[model samples]
Target: MKMKVESVNLTDPSLLLRPEPVYDGKPVSAFRNFDDDENDPMKARVRKTYYDMHTNMSVDFVKAKMAKWLKFNHFKATMKEALIKLNDLVDESDPDIDLPNIVHAFQTAERIRDEHPDEDWFQLIGLIHDVGKVMAFYGEPQWCVVGDTFALGCKWGPSIVYGDDSFRDNPDTHNPKYNTKYGMYEPNCGLENLLMSWGHDEYLYRVLVHNKAKFPKKALHMIRYHSFYPWHAGGDYQHLLKEGDEEIKQAVLEFNKYDLYTKSAGIPDVEALWPYYESLIEKYIPGVLEW
Candidate 1:
């Protein structure tokens, strides 16, 4: 599955350190509802999805999933091909947009492009961020691939969506070693060392690292933890932070503004936009990649 990738010029340090954009129109805060709204018809499905995830995503499950996917033996396709395949995946776990996931891919990328035109790598990361949800297309269920990820081996923070009511049946909730606040990990153990619930975020992060993609640390952190609503959004899990997470946390929050707000019912013209994104992909992660 290996193919040679030409070296893409890295981002200029000046562009990487640009100040955050001033968002126009409505604030992104309007869309941050993680709890079930009694009037919203999608509540039942969303609740059930979280219930399944919280009930089954234990330390053992995370370990087994890491072993399975970290092998990277699933299949091979270029970044464009993988992004197209996402059109077939409708994330039942997402309460936002019910349209094909490809629309959100372009929406997120386009939003970034509009605001941070100088950060081409950042825009590309937006398009491919959810490409890891392709795991569902390969036989993994929606719950396993699309839900918000949390640290599996630690205490489930109150910030997790439905964290209080859903994990009652989970075995880890009763395990003496894992039931406590610190669980199996020590305080201030950086997120890189903890096992997160298996999902698209972790999958795509690993894929980029294994293939030696040219993304920097900020891009890597955003890819791995975009769905970590509990930490980035809820302001929980500060107790688990290591020394330098302050900067990474800021980047994740900035990225979240685009990821959450850009989702819409409008679909992008995939064929027309293909050329520009293809060039960007070639520049960064060229050739067929391991699935």
Candidate 2:
């Protein structure tokens, strides 16, 4: 049976506490499955997105993208204005949800609010975490703007969705400086020191800093590494971690639960929720932001 959105009890404390929450009638383990099935359109779409991402996401490519986007010269808009624009985007790399990205944004924020009622900054983080995806409107493709992020100039994590098979076509796979386990990084250099692949995660984190958003450091950390599945979720890159990095991993894990499992949650009344979230936006990330 299809799980109706209304069936989820967002207020149930137990629901918030469960380690393996159910979504759309599937067990949590069933989520994030990257198995190939050419006959399945959703699966095929996801595979193609990752294949393209792996094929082209080289060190030089990521550097060039950073040069293009990090200038913050793109159009300026308030956080709310940027979020509303997501109503037109459907992430091609997501196999789970087909709804406009805006719906997922509210679903994530609302769930975080329910669980961490006092942490307004965390709730705001949830609301705006994907706002960097507004890059899609400026001609960036979904493959680079959405989906999971991994570190560049290092061996690809075995836990990355499609594993080595998907990255076979990438030129970096053959490059001596990038394909090794440690690659260009020294031992214990820490997560922040690594050059992560260019994506919304890095883009929005920089934007928040550049605009002087007042969110706490932990909130900024959550937003920055939430999509770094290989490091946070897959136990990769341990040799590169420094002291206190475990706390960062735990923080990302706490935020990631809502991000991944809330996709099938009930469609929020965004119109009704905006006033509350707007207060949050005003508090932490007010004003027209340079994209």
Backbone clashes in model 2, listed as residue pairs? none
Where does model 2 exceed 4 Å of error? 1-17, 21-24
Candidate 2 whole-model C-alpha lDDT, 0 to 1: 0.84
Go through the candidates in order and give each one's C-alpha lDDT: 0.80, 0.84
Candidates in order, TM-scores: namely 0.88, 0.92
- Quote the positional error of residue 220 for candidate 2 in Å: 0.9
lDDT of 2 at 255: 86
For residue 105, give model 1's deviation from the true position in Å: 0.3
Q: Report backbone clashes per prediction.
A: 0, 0
- Model 2 lDDT per residue over 100-190, tens place: 9999999999999999999999999989999899999999988899888999998987777777877898989999999999999999999
Highest TM-score: give the candidate number.
Answer: 2
